[model samples]
Target: MNQPASLPLAESLLAAPLPAGGPAWLDAARREHRAAFAAGGLPDTRIEAWKYTALRGLAQRRFADGDAAAAARGVDVAAFALPGVEGPRLVFVNGVFRADLSALEALPAGVSLQPLSQALRGDAEPLRFALSRPALVGHGREAGDAFAQINAARAADGVVLRVAAHAKSIAPVRLVFVGAAADAELAWHARNVIELGEGAELDLVEQHVSLGEQAQLATLVSDIELGDHARLRHVVVQDAAAGANLIRRSGLRLHARAQATLHVLELGGALVRHDLRAELVGDGAQFHTRGVFMPHGRQHIDTQLAIRHQALDTTSSSHWRGVAGDRARGVFRGAIVVAPGADGSDANLSNKNLLLSPAAEIDTKPELEIYADEVKAAHGATVGQLDERSLFYLRSRGIPLGEARALLTAAFCRAMLDDLPNAVLREHLSGLLIAQLPA
Candidate 1:
């Protein structure tokens, strides 16, 4: 396959040189993936996985390589502080690790956390399985998408976290990625590898923020593994600049009796997309996710989720909400599959969206495929507006029309965050959600 002539983004990225000097196996893997990306370029809307979100504008643009002054970038550390989270922290500036801005003191016992660049410098043997993987699993036909391939080829620094067997982290680990305004449009790639040993437990918070408005592109890929009897709680908050474009993909695998839960908020960025995939490879495994995406102005946000139940008695559930105002657009897709011989499996998904303006648009699709007998599966999606009677009632009570509309909109999105355990973080997130609404 020849690289598409319309895709200047891919041509510019592939022209940049990879980091020099690594183990023979790692180098070979990078070369192979780079060649693959050079051949395939980017996927278009004709592909089933990209039917809703188009990349024509992105394909016409060109971006520089990594940021050269990432280490010297001036950032206000106090701006990103959360109320209740005070654990070990790792901060990346334009995809490069910044030791001066990180807080790594008093790390909990049995937990090993470090930057991927540092780990690769020493004994990288432990990370071979994740780094050497050919393609992202569970993505079906889009497993070899261009973004993931380029990330595998060009990524050099990211989060590398591991927990020992039976160890429990008292405080949540925070990973922060800050995008600062650069001299020119640039592109950066990151790869994260996280694993929890048998009987381990952990809570993680991932954040993406921006310092100022800059036209840049960012791609990230994360691989997560949970062993038998392990548990994980993950949260993500994304608030990038309006001129930024962000793409991310995450793959998770669960063993026997393992459990994982996730909460996500997508609020900023000119163009943003997330692909989340999970597999239950052992019996009694469970996965749950709750999320909300609000796009105002001309922003575009898309979320794709896929789950597979490959073992007996596995369970999965998802609930998500979307709010689009102005001329913005929102897209959501939820897919669940029950493999053969996987009896007693249960799965359900629901997505509800609200459109606030005549010019705004929302696209949603819910899919389910069951190949096993005695399995329960269900999925649904809806798009509509706020109730007129509720708005009228609020106006009759002396509240201004604008305030009433904001009140109802806030309530609609707040339901997804009601069950969050952390009071401080929950309130903060709620405030952010309200701030993003049209006033």
Candidate 2:
């Protein structure tokens, strides 16, 4: 990797003064992250990890730092909110927690929820400990990960949801992040932390959208920890503005016998990338991830997933489906690493994509690194278009060519969409997905 002589945007950000409050340790951490960003700089298309996605436009933009005190006017909650998936909502507009637009109804007992900005100002020992944990992210500390470092140094407002031991929260907690409605280009960074105690259970949902066509740069990070025997179901939906550059990364650590199920749907963005990593550190831990990414026009969407098996009898499975139409491009990279002592680990990864047009492109990379002798791991990827036989059969059955193509393409991604636990959300996503297809 070639280092640049100067980084104007990064230098401009670092020239500003740091936040006033926080403990000595946090200040030192921020300084370290800032220094790391300066040393590594922005990643270019030449890098292997970023070969498919380019950051030249993002680096050239002039963006001002986000202001938590800035009021978000004309925010319509009904537009972004789901029809029947309503309960315990937290809305953050331009990286600021909007209390007036939030609803904390039907919260279960033994659950504590608050904004991270408030906790950072007061005594937030738990948050500090969790953030400082070594196993929070598998490989985010590397110098080349500039976005992770920047987020660590500048994150201000986010959610902090913690469940007590042996408790269960049946209602899903929705975290909605809205971008700027104004035309000014703004840079917002936020970090959310979620912790579940032993024998605890909960459902979490996150949605990202924008109100205007502003060229906003939003960086969001999530840190999740599950105690022994804990269970969690996580879902994410990204449909930001047409000109937004969004980078959302999430890392989780699973303890003994812990289980996690994650579902992601990416439908809209100009340049969007998501990095999701999970570490199975204890015996009998299980991690499963599924996603669907569809990009059309001149849009670009990338999904990177890495799972590490560090203990015996651990298991992980990842399945992703993508569809690229028009002149759009899509990428999926999934990696599973089995440690030396992680014998009896089972891992499976599969990625299948469809190219709806001659101009569209899809790139799939599935890899498995196994150092253990007694592990079972398999990885595979496929990039192709709709089956001609199936299309012909549908057309022969009195269906038009366009309708048949759309039906087969939708069915190709239905396996992952059907696994979504929520009926209303699934139905809503199904409708939205079909509407985006080439009609």
Candidate 3:
């Protein structure tokens, strides 16, 4: 079959030369994944996993490989800093690591943090198992998507973090990805690997921001593993430029007695999609997540979440909220599955959405599949506008109609930030949520 003309991005990427000078195995793996992507091309809406998000627009756009001047890009360091988050930080501009802008001098004794490119330079053997995995296999079938294949083949730099056994970090580690304006449209790929040893505890924050309005294509693939009794608190804030298109996939695995909690805020981008999949592979494992996505103007945001219970007595819970205004659109899918023989598993998911304009749209889907005995699973979703009575009451108190609407919308979205442990950070996030509403 001839490659379609709509897929110029894939064709252009396939024609570019691969990265030079790596281990023979690394080179071979990149070639194999690139071949797989070339054979499959970009997936269409016909695929069940991609029904709500279409790539035809993205496919028609062509992008340069990366920003060669990323290191020289003048970015104000103070712009992307967060309150009460003064710790080890890794900064990347246009998917390239910047040593001068990054702060990695005084990392904790047991914590090892560095960019993937640096780790690959010396003793690349330690990362072989992760970097060499087939892109289209395992992990709830979400990891096998076309974007994952692209990242596996083209990603040259990202974050590599490790925490030793029984060690706890008092401060949170931050990973910042900043998109800067380039002379031409660009495409970048990044791969992140994070592991926590047994009995270790850590807090991680990941942020995506842009220096200015620039049309760019970016793909990120992250693999996280939590050992027995390890605990992780993960937070993500996505506030890219309105012209940027960002796609990301994250896979997490929890072992015995491991607990992982996630808080995410999606508030920017022209077109954005996130695929998050988690596996509870050990007894007594727990996973909890809360997120909010607000797409205003003409932006489109989609989030796909899947959780699988593969062990006895595992528990999982998810709560997500969405608000779309103007002509924007939002999509959310939460799916949970319990394998046979995984008894005593409990899973729950709830998704609520609000439409702020007649032209706005929100799609919410909640699915549950249970083959195990003694399992308790529940899922629900709702799409509607704000209550008229609440708005009326506020307006009667002398508040203008627009102010009342903004107040109600802010309150609706701030519910997702109530449980954040850091007071300063939580307040900052709440302020950002309120700022995102139309005034």
TM-score of each: 0.97, 0.95, 0.97
Rank by TM-score, highest first: 1, 3, 2
Q: What is the C-alpha lDDT of each candidate?
A: 0.90, 0.83, 0.90
RMSD of 2: 2.3
Q: Which tens-of-lDDT digit does each residue in 1-439 have in candidate 3?
A: 2234337888877776777666888889899888778767786776676777777788888999989999999999986989968899999999999998899976887999999999888888878988888756333334237788878889999999999998887889999999999999999889999999999899999999999879999999999999999999999999999999999999999999999999999999999999999999999899999999999999999999999999999999999999999999999989999988789999999999999999999988899999999999999999999999999999999999999998988888889889999999999999989999987
Please list the residue runs of candidate 1 whose C-alpha ends up more than 4 Å from where it truly belongs after superposition: 1-6, 135-144
- Ten contiguous residues minimizing lDDT sum, candidate 1: 135-144
How well does candidate 1 match the true structure in TM-score terms?
0.97
Residue-level lDDT of model 2, residues 248-336, one tens digit each, is 88889999999999888898889999989999999999999888999999999999888999999999999899999999999888989
Instruction: Indicate the TM-score of model 3.
Output: 0.97
Candidate 1 accuracy as lDDT: 0.90
Task: Give candidate 2 misplaced runs (Cα > 4 Å).
Answer: 2-5, 67-69, 132-144
Please report, as a residue range, the 10-residue window in candidate 2 with the lowest summed lDDT: 134-143
